[model samples]
Target: MRPLIVFSDLTLDGYMTGPGDDLGFMVDDPALEAESTGELRNVADAIVVGRKVFPEMSAYWTSAEGDLAHWMNTAPKHLLTTDPSVDTSAWGNTVLEVGDGIERVRELKAKQGGALVVFGGTATVRSLIAADLVDQYWLKINPVLTGAGGSPFTALAGQRRLTLESARAYSSGTVLLVYTS
Candidate 1:
């Protein structure tokens, strides 16, 4: 099975976003998005995201230009959702994945693909982490502290240990913390 990498931006307090999915806490650096997500594009051929945030991500990337945009639009997106009313055909290259998410991800990992990168909707991230399915975690930790917000590792079913792979700090006061299970 190919490696599964999960990337997320977190505050010093371990919050992924402010209340209501607000990401206004992070410092604005266009290069950050390109530099960070750009790397994922190089190693990953497909993206798995939750249905909740799929539309928002798709809309933002559809009108984007450049390498990141190309990768985001071209990579086949698999949306995990139980909603039967969702029309996957509305998107260019999307598939609705129902049933066991962990099982589905395992099946995808078994395929002959490069890597499967997961984008978020809080619940999905937490679920994957809880299931111990994530192979690698790429967390960009900002210097700021958000007293209250959304976290990607909330309510984990069991404790999972990780080994520190690397840690690098960027000029934006953001530190990239890489960990592997």
Candidate 2:
């Protein structure tokens, strides 16, 4: 089965984004961007995201032409959402799975493909982790500290353990931590 991977950036305090979706506290280092984006492309044959992330990310990346853009546009995408009203016809190679996120993801992983990369969607990530469906995690630890913000693991019902797979430091002081369950 293809591995389910979670890629996210968090502050020193483990907040994914500041309160009210304030993303100003997030740092963007060139080196980190290149490395993270490259890794994301390499590992995943398709990206599985929440409905909320699909419109924003698809609009931006599908129109921009680059390695990441090319990968995103051509690669298959699965959006997990319960809303049947969402129209995804404009997005090429995109599928809408309106059911339990974890079960839908598991079905996707069973298909023949590379890893399924998941970005944002903390709720979905937490569900996958709790179900032991995620195989890898790529967390970019930012330097700033957010007193209040979205957490990396919020909806998780219980404690879970992971093994460190690799770590890298960026020029801007952001650290990329890779883990496996």
Candidate 3:
């Protein structure tokens, strides 16, 4: 089984997004995205995202052009959703409906493949964390604080210790923290 990496952005206050789901604090640097996510593209064959994140991800990435966008658009994706009525016709990702939880991820991990990555969905990340399914976490921590916002780690039933693999600081003031569980 290949590694399952959670590649995400978080504010200094540990918020994934600010109030009202404002992502204004996220870095707008194309080079940064290329540098980070682009690296994962080589090893990450598939993406797993929650239903709540797919619409926004699809709408933006389908029209965006770049190496990162190409990976985002072409990756075979598993959209975790209990809703059977969702229109899975999005062109960005080759979308397959999946049960809304971590069981499918568990099964996927047992197979031979490249890494399965969680790019944007916090709920998906949190669920995987709860299930102890995530093998590695690559968090890009931005140097700003959102006093109130969404935390992917919140509401976790218990603690899971992680080993810090590496920490690198980028010129954009975003620090990349990689961990292995």
Which sections of candidate 1 miss by over 4 Å? none
| Candidate 2 lDDT score at position 107 | 94
- Per-residue lDDT tens digits for candidate 2, residues 51-165, read 7667777777767865666777888888899997888876788888988887898899899988998886566666777788889988889999879987767767878789999
Give me the displacement of residue 17 in model 1, in angstroms.
1.8
User: Which candidate number has the best TM-score?
Assistant: 3
lDDT of 1 by residue, 70-136 (tens): 7878889888887867876645788878877778888888999888988787778888888888999
Candidate 2: stretches off by over 4 Å? 63-65
- TM-score per prediction, in order, is 0.89, 0.89, 0.92
Report residue 146 deviation for candidate 1 (angstroms): 1.4
- Candidate 1's TM-score reads 0.89
By lDDT rank, best first, the candidates go 1, 3, 2
